[model samples]
Structures are given as structure tokens and as C-alpha cells.
Target: MLNFFKKKAALVWAKKHVLKSGEFKKNSVKNQEALLLSLVKTAEKTLFGREHDFESIRSVKEFQDRVPVADYEDLKPYIERVKKGQANILWTETPEYFAKTSGTTSGSKYIPISKEGMPFQIAGAQSALFHYIAQKNNADFVNGKMIFLQGSPEMEEVFGIKTGRLSGIVAHHIPGYLQKNRLPSWNTNIMEDWEAKVEKIIEETEHENMTLISGIPPWLIMYFEKLTEKHGKKIKQLFPNLQLLVTGGVNYEPYRDKMNDLLGGKVDIIQTFPASEGFFAFQDDYTKEGLLLLTDHGIFYEFIPLEEYGKPEARRLTLKDVELNKDYALILSTNSGLWAYSIGDVVRFTGKDPYRILVSGRTKHFTSAFGEHVIAFEVEEAMKATVEKNAAQITEFHLAPQVNPTEGLPYHEWLIEFEKEPENLELFRSELDEQLRARNTYYDDLITGNILQQLHITPLKKNAFHEYAKSQGKLGGQNKTPRLANDRKIADLLEIYKL
Candidate 1:
């Protein structure tokens, strides 16, 4: 009787979400503009607002003119003030929680999640699930257990506010009704060691009717591997009811083949764009290739063309000014008090009418070591194509420029952990090089000019990436090994695991 009611309620909620989504789609531009004005007005008295003269900003252009695009370092002083229990430093009120995230340049970043803005974070994720339910017209998953493999929910008091991983903070906000169906009990979740936690999770959930599983792709792959090792059965055989796989943090295409193989069958996969800054987009249509950007989720967005990302005269474009298929740096001004903040992500528009986007790469995470800029999207696409063509399954891969190889011209080095090595290694390498060269004209030019040699692949031992992550003390919880790097920091560390 309880399961029946839950399904009915879920269906009802999904229907309402469809209606609401339609309205938002039709009014995306209007909603964004209004959201910006509201955010400006709400933060008018705050320190950042006063400094930027937010009170006088009446239009998007005016706001753009008044407020310069900023990265985390630019706002660190204000965040520091907030950490000391200061109110109205970044927002109108003190933050309820700080979503702590590991940063590249900055050591640790604590993104403020105000009481007013917190609901939107939860809503964006909920809406993603509701969108799936509506499109598939299937709410039967609600009757079965769902597991969100995430950070430990344990939090620490930084000043007077709670501080923890973004996933951990979000774990605290799971809707009450779904609590009963959520897996891996509290004690299991708070376990500090990722390996131990995964073991506990398997023990708790291996026999349950797991209908949905959610986590970053690499971590989820790890969990799947552990399950198969213990039971000696495919994931689908162990959990026949499993219906959905929700993923985010990194691109899913590279890992899709291996994940599907481990699952033993097909399952619906939903990719989301989530960060400590906010939940920006999610796969709303299973048939579609891009995620539906959440326009009404209390975030006002701006885009800087990838070519002009760091230029002083770079145009900050509104939704109306964006063009399809052009990569742009995603910028945000949210109700949480972030203004003209660069989230360091590069995105490309896939649709204009309803505003769907694909996360292409990160602004800082490209390899330009040889004047041939290679982004994460290009490499992942190249790897995906090559892997499919060669009948290979990769566990994980990383790319870095081999600028000073001992006995050759400078070249790109591909460190790959293959679950199934290609039959012909040299042919696989040449084909992969061709695929990447076809996508990146700059790389092709460099190769043709004899400036750089073809990329070299270093086959890695099994669980190489896992060992690398463990070595860095970032084995789990939203941490992902970068696909490519401008520097050889990660590549040098991964050398010892070479097969």
C-alpha cells in the first residue's frame, strides 16, 4: 500500500514539474534577467554589492559593466570574512553551510550556501529526477531502494556554520520521504575511508532491490567492480530492479562502455552538471545528448567566448547573444551572492529554444603546452571513438605533453589504464592520434610541421588510477583525476604504475 501511494505521488509531482519546466523554457530570458535584478537588489546592502555599486545597476549590460568577472582568488577576502562569522559580506544573511571543495590553485574552497539559496541546490537535483520520471513515464523505481554514493555527511563547525563536502552538505538535505529508501545507513556513510565505506555499502545494499544508483562515474565504476568481485555476478544480475544511474563531476562518455560492461546490461543514465557553486544543469531528456540548463534555479548566467576568456574586452553575453556549438566560459551571478563569478567550466550550447548545454571542458584544465590547446572534450571524444573502433575498454586515462622526452621530439603522452587492451597496440595509438588530430586543427598543424611527434600511450597496470588517487589522498567524494593537464604534475606521479 505504501509503495503504491509513493508511485502515485511521484507521478503527480513529475506531471507538475513538466508543466513548470515548459513555463521556464518559454521564459528563460525573462527569468534570467529578473533573477539577476532580484539578486542585485537583495545584495545591495552587502559589502560586495556596495563595492560594485549594485544599487545603480538596472540592466544586464549595466551589471556586467559594473562588476568584473572574478575567480575564487578574487573573492577570497570576502569569503574569509564570512568564515569569521561576518554577516552580509557576500550575501544579505550569514551562510547556513559552506560547501567545501578541493581547488586546483587555491588549496580548499568554501562556497557559501545561504538559507535562501540552499533550496535551489536541492530543487535542481529533485527536478532532474522528476524530469526523468515524467519523460520515461515510469515511477516504479520509487518503490525500490536508491543509493547515492557520496561524501560522508559528517560536518564540522567553521565559526558558527557547518562546513563539509558539497555532496555531504547535500546529503543532509535529502527529502524526508525518500530517507527510508536511501541506502548505506548513517554509520556506513560517515565512514572516513572510501574503501571501507564501499565495502560497508556492498554489505548493506548487495541484497536489496537497488533501483537507482548515483555518484561520479569513476567512483561508481569502482563500486561496481567491488560488487562483481564479491558476488562474481554482473550488477544487473545482482540487482535486477536497478533502473537508473545518475552521474556528474566528470564527462561520462569515456567511462560509459566499461560501466555498461560491468552492469551486464543497459540502464538509463542521467548526466548532471553540479559543483559547490551550484547545480547548473541535468539530462532532462534521455534521448537528448545535452543537459537542460536550469534557467529558473536562482542563477543568472553569463558566457564569455572561450577564445576571449581572459581578455579585458571579452564580451559577457546573455542567453540571447549565445550561438549554438561555440564553446564559452560559464559565468554566474546567483542568489547566494556570487556576482559575475567564473565557475571555470567551458560549455557549448546544443539547443537554443529550450537552452540545452554540454559541458565541454574546464577553463583551466586544458593542455596548451605546445601552443596546440587540447581540451578535455576533444580527448574524451577521441578516446571514445578509438576505444569503440578497437573493441577496447578503458578503466581510466590521462593526457599530458611530453615536452622533454629523453629520446624524441616533444609529444603528447597518453597514460591509459585499459580493462581490455586493443589487439594491435601501435594501430590503436595511430588511430587515436588521427581521431584527435581530426578534432584539433592546431594539433594537426603541429604534427604536420614536425613540431611534435604523434602521442605516445603508456599502458598502465590495473587499478592504476585508484592507486594514484589514493596516493594523492583523494580517493573519493567528488575528486576526479583530470583528463588532461597543462603541466606534467599528474603524469609524472602516474609513471610508477606503467605496465
Candidate 2:
């Protein structure tokens, strides 16, 4: 009976999702305006609503004139007030929970998740499967457990509101019927010790019929290794039924070779763009062109040109205004009281009709110290080519500019913590450098003109990144190793494990 309901749900959502995607393709401007108007109408009585004169938002321009784009820092005061039991400060009601994100230069951030906004997050997750069912038409995957490797759901309260990691918060909302089939039992799930939790998770799920495995790429790689050590075989031998591998939070390209070696088959991968702010997009099609944006969801979309970000008069483009193939810092106004919020993600539109995007990198994370201007997406793509060519696997890595402080020709340094070491490290380094040079004209000019040294690689000791993250109290679960750093702070700290 439960299986029947699950299949029915997937098929139902698949039809509805496909129809919506098509609807947005032909009527994006109309649908987007409707969504924005609906949001304004619903929250016209809330604090932000009253302050911004939401009642006056007859058009997108009026809405933008009333609400300026802001980052999390701009709203911290309001969040703090909410933490003190304030009501209707941002949303119509007080947030029922807060999603704790990684501490920044300013310290940790607690993003409020209001009652109306929770469904948006769940909808993205469901759409991943709906797309799968719509394309593949295989509902048997639902009969078995769809194990999601995420943070534990152990809740704590602050100022009468619950708080935890976003994944943990989502875990709590998993209905009991679906909960029974999930992995990492509640006891093991709640264990704060990451190493111990991983071990117990491996022990429990080593033999289960896992049809879907979803999480960030790096941590999932670690779990795959444990499964190999446990069963002395690849994932295919362990669970041949496994069909879908969904990844988010980081690029999956560099890990493709090692993952292919582990999974050993053509398992379809569905990528998603989920953030603590809100679940934004998902790969609805088989071809990896871009992720289909959820325009009709309870989120209003905006984009600011990367060059204009943080400027006093940055032009904010609504969905109707965004152009194709242009890099822009993505902003969102959501039902969750986050109005015109810059979530810090940079993306480029791949399609304009149905509205699809490819995440570029963080607005602050890039290297242009010498005017080369390298983005994280380009770096990852270069690394992917190098890794696949060399059959190497990277556990974790960080890149930084080596300036005149090093007392020689300045260069870019790549400190890599390798799990499956490359056979020829120098060749890997040279190839990766060349790949980037080919992608960026300015970078290629510097290399050809001898203005910069060839990129250098520092092979790190095993578990070096794990140790570093552990020391920083971010051993696992949503805390990603910074891929690109403007300064030597991350590389310098990880230098202890340099070979």
C-alpha cells in the first residue's frame, strides 16, 4: 500500500513538474510576475511587508524600488531580533526553525525558515525524483529505501525556535512511513562525532538495497571507500540495484573518475542546487546543459552582474530581464521573509526560454591578483580534465596565489590532498595548468609571456584535509573545504601535511 502511494506520488509529481517546466518555457514572464505578486500579497501585513510598502508593488520595478538587494550580513540584526523571540519581523509569523550555516569572518549565521518556506525546500527534493520518474519511468526505485546521507536530526531551541543544520531540519520532517526505510538509524544519525557516525552508517547500510545515494561528492566518496573495504568489491557488486546518484554542494566533475571506478556502471546522476537559503534548481534533463530553475516556487529571482556586485547602483535583473550566458550573482526574494537576498552564488543562464542556469562560483571566491581572473567553475573544469586524463582522485584541495612574499616569480599554488594518488604528479600539474590557460585568455598570456611561473602542486598527506576540517570543528556535514582562497590562510594552515 505504501509502495503504491509512493509510485502514485512520483508519477503525479512528474506530470505536474513537467507541465510546470513547459508552462514556464512559454510564459516565464507571466508566471514569474504572478509568483512575485502572490508573495507580496501574502506577506503585505508582515514587518518587512509594511516597511517596504509591499501593498504598493504593482510591478517588478516598484518591488525593486522598495527593496534593495542585501546579503546575510544586512539582515543579521533582524535575525538576531527573531532569535530573541520577536514575531513578524521579517515573515508573517516568527520562523519555526533556524538553519545554522558555517561561521564566516563575522561568525555563524542562522537563516530563518518560516512555516511557508519549508515546502519550497521539500519541493526541490521531490522534483529530483519526479524528473527521474518522468524521464526513466522506473518507480521500483521508490519501493526500496531512498537513502539520503545527510546531517542528523537532533534539535535544539533558541528563543523558543528550533534550530539545526538544514539537512537535519529536513530529516525531522521525513514522514514516519518514509522514515522507516532511511539509513543511519536515529541513534547513529544523532552522534555528533562524524568519524563514529560514518563507521556505524557503513556497518548498517553495507548490505542494504540502496537504489539512490545522494549527498555532496567528497563525503559520498568516503562512504564508497568504506563500502569497498567492507565488501571487497565495487558498489555494483554490493548493490546492483542502485540506479541514481544525486550530488550537490560541490562540483562533481573532478570526482567522476574515482566514482566511476567505484560504482562501475552507467548510473544516472541528477544534480541539484540546494542551499540553506532555499533549494533553487535541479537537473531536470539527462543532458548536463543546466539545472531547471523553479520559477513558480515561492521564490522571486533576481540577478546582478558579477562586476556590479556590491556596487551602490548595481542593476538587478528580474527573470524577464536576465540574458543568456552572462555571469551574474544570483539573488532571491522568498516567502521565508528573505527579501532581495544575495545568497552569494554566481551563476550563468544556459537557457532563457524555460530558464536554466549553471552555478559559476561564489562572488568573493576568485583569483585576479595578477589580473588573470580565474573562477572556481573554470578551475574545477580544468581539474576535471586533468583528473580524468591521469585517473587520479582528489579528496580535497585549495588554490591560492603565491605573490612576491615568496621571493620569486609569483605563481598559483595548488595544495591537493589526494586519496587516489596520480601516477605522474608533475604531468597532472602541467596538464591542469594548460587546461586553465586554454580556458582563460589572460591566464594564457601570462604563462606564454613568462610573467608567471607554471602552477605548483603540493601533495598533502593522507586525511590532511579531514584533520584540518576537524581542527576547525567542521569535520563533516555541509562544511566544504574552501576550493579557492584569496590569501594563503587556508594553504598555510594545511601546509603541515605537505609532502
Candidate 3:
């Protein structure tokens, strides 16, 4: 009876909140400007606010003229002060906690989690579920356990401000009612050993009526593999009522086949674009091609055209001025007190009627080393098409440009850890090479003109990336294998495990 009531409540919440997201998009530009003004007004007395002259800024143009787009390097001083218990540096007063990010350039970064920004994060989380529920008409989601493969919630404090993995921080915030139906209790969640945690999670959830599962795509694959290995049955047999999958942090196109195959059937997969900095976007409609940007979530957004991103005097546009299909590097200022911050992500607008977008790639995560300039989306699409053509499954992969003449010619090198190796390796390579050439004219021009060598493939030993990530102390919790390294750092690391 209680479970039925909970399901009904979830349905009702879905209707109300999904409608709210719609309304939020309808007034995206105005709401975004208002959010920026409100944020500026609230922080008008802070050091950053004062330096940027937030008090005099009454419009987006004024704000743009006053503040330059900044990355983590530019804001490290203020973040350092915040970590040392300083108040009103980046944010007004001290933050309630900090979301520690695993940055490859640095060890980790403590991003402020202001009390004012918490509700927006929470709302985004709620809306993720609500959008999924509304799309699939999830009438019984609350009746069964929803297993979220999360990280350790045991937080460490720096000058009285608690910090841990971003996913762990979010895990600790899951509402009380849902907690009752959540799998992998605190004991397993805080185990600190990922393999052991998986074992314990299988034991704990093996008998439960699991309706939903959420995690990064690779981790979800790991859990499914473990479940099949231990139970001697498919995922559908293990949990007959499993309804849907919610995943984020990496593109799912590459793993989509294997994930559904392990389930013995097709399952609805909802994508989300949640980051430590903010919950930026979520899949709001089944009919929509891109994610609905959560415009009202205390975030003010700006976009830099990808072509002119690094140019000193390039232009920046707000939500109202963006065009469809052009890749734009995203910049944001939030109530969390990150001003004119470039989070390093790039996205493209897909639907302007409701401000829907697709996360195209990262600002630094691309291959332009010979002017081939291939992005993550193109690579992902190429890989997907190649795998489907070859009938294969991928476990993990990392890509880097091989520029030195040691190999006789410059080419893109792929280090792939496959779940099942292809029947004909050379043909798989050929298909991928052909597909990429078909997709990107610049890449094709290089290959066709014989300016660059053909795609060089190196099939890796099992768990190559997992071991590499472990070596880097970045093993789990939404941390992905860097898809494209700026140079040979990751490629050099993977050379040791070449098959």
C-alpha cells in the first residue's frame, strides 16, 4: 500500500516538474539573464563581484564586457582561498561543502557548493527522474528498488568544508523516501574497493525487485558482466522487473549494443549531462534529439563559436543568440559563484524552440594535430558504425595523435580494450578508417592526400584502461578514460599493455 502511494506520488511529481522544465525553456533567455543579474546582485559585495563591477552590470553585454571567460587555472587563487576557510572570495560567505573534481592537469580541484546552489542541483536531479518517468510513463518506478552505482560518501574536510567525489556528494543527497528503495546500502557504497563494492552490490541487490539502474556506461557494463558471471544467468533473469537505465559522464553510443545485449532485450536508456560544477542538461523528451538545457537552474550561460574559441578577440553569445548545428564551447556563471567560467565543455544547439543541446566534446579534447581536427562525436559515430558493421563489443578506448616520424608517417593511434575482439582485425580497422574518412573531410583530405598514414590500431589486453586509471588514482565514480589526450601522455602509458 505504501509502495503504491509512492508510485502515485512519483507520477504526480513527474507531471508537475516536467511541465516546469518546459516552462523554463519557453523563457530560457529571459530567465538566464535574470538569473545572471540575481547572481551578480547577490555577490555584488564579494571580491570577484566587485572586481568585475557586478553592481553596474544591468545587461548581458555589460557583464560580458566586464568579465573575461575563465578556466580553472584563472580561478585557482579564489578556489584556494575558499578551501582555506576564506569567506566571500568566490562565493558569498563560505560554501556548505565543496565538490572535488579529478582534473588531469592538476590532482584535484575544490569547487564551491554554495547553499544557494544546492537546491538547483537537487532540482536537476529530481527533474532527471521526472523526465525519464514522463517519457516512459513510469507508473511503477517507486514500487521497486532503484539501484544507483555510486561512489563513497565518506567525505574529507578541508578547513571545515567537507569534500569528496562529486558523485559521492550527490549520492549523499538522494531524498529520504527514495533512499528506502535504493540498493547497495551504505556498507557496500563506502567499501572503498570497487571490485569488492561490485560483489557486495550483487549480493545485496540480487533478490530485490529492481526497477531502475543508473551509472556511467562502462561501470554499468562492469556490473552487468559481474552479475552474469556470478549468477550464471542473464540480467533479465537476475532481476525480472528491471525497467530502465539512466547513464551519463560519457557518450553511450559505443556501449549501447553490449548493454542492451546483456539484458536479453532492449531497455530504455535515458542520458543526462550532470557534472560536478552543475547539473547542466537532461534528456527531457523521447521525440527530441538533444538534451533540454536546464535554463532556470541558477546558471547563466554563454557560448563561444568553436572556430574562434582560442582567438583572443572572438565573440561570445548568450542563450538567445546561439544558432542551430554550430558547435559552441560553453561558458557559464552560476550562483555557486563561478563567474564567466569555461567548464571546458563544447555543445551544439539542436532544438531552439526549447533550447535543446548535444554535448559535442571538450574544449581541449580533440585531434587537430595535423589539421585533421576530428571531434569526439565524429569518432563516437565512426566507432559505432564500425562496431555494428563488424559485430564487436568494446570495453574501453583512448585515442591520441602519433606525430613523430618513428612510425614513418603521422597517423591517429587507437588503443582499444575490447570485450570481444573482432573476427577480422584488419577489416575492423578498414571499416573504422573508411567511416571516419566519410564523416570528416579534413581527416579524409589528410588520408586521401597521403599527408597522414592510415588509422593504426592496437588491440589492448583486458582492463588496460581500468589498470591505467587505477595507476592515476582515478578509478571510478563517473571518471572516464580520457577519450582524446592532448598529446602522447595516455598513449605512452597504454603502450606497456599492448596486446
The number of the candidate with the highest TM-score is 1
Q: How far is 114's C-alpha from truth in model 3 (Å)? A: 0.7
Task: Supply the global lDDT for candidate 2.
Answer: 0.84
TM value for model 2:
0.94
Better of 2 and 3 by lDDT: 3
Model 2 lDDT at residue 44: 91
Candidate 3 C-alpha error for residue 497, in Å: 2.6
lDDT by candidate, in order shown: 0.92, 0.84, 0.85
Better of 1 and 2 by lDDT: 1
Ranking by lDDT: 1, 3, 2
Q: How many clashes (backbone N, Cα, C below 3 Å) per candidate?
A: 0, 0, 0
C-alpha positional error of residue 467 in candidate 1 after TM-score superposition, expressed in Å? 0.4
Q: What are the models' TM-scores?
A: 0.98, 0.94, 0.96
lDDT, candidate 1, 108-191, per-residue tens: 998999898899889989999999899988988988999987788999998999999888888889999889999989999999
Q: What is the TM-score ranking, best to worst?
A: 1, 3, 2
Predicted candidate 2, C-alpha RMSD: 2.2
Against the true structure, what is every candidate's RMSD? 1.0, 2.2, 1.7
Clashes of 3: 0
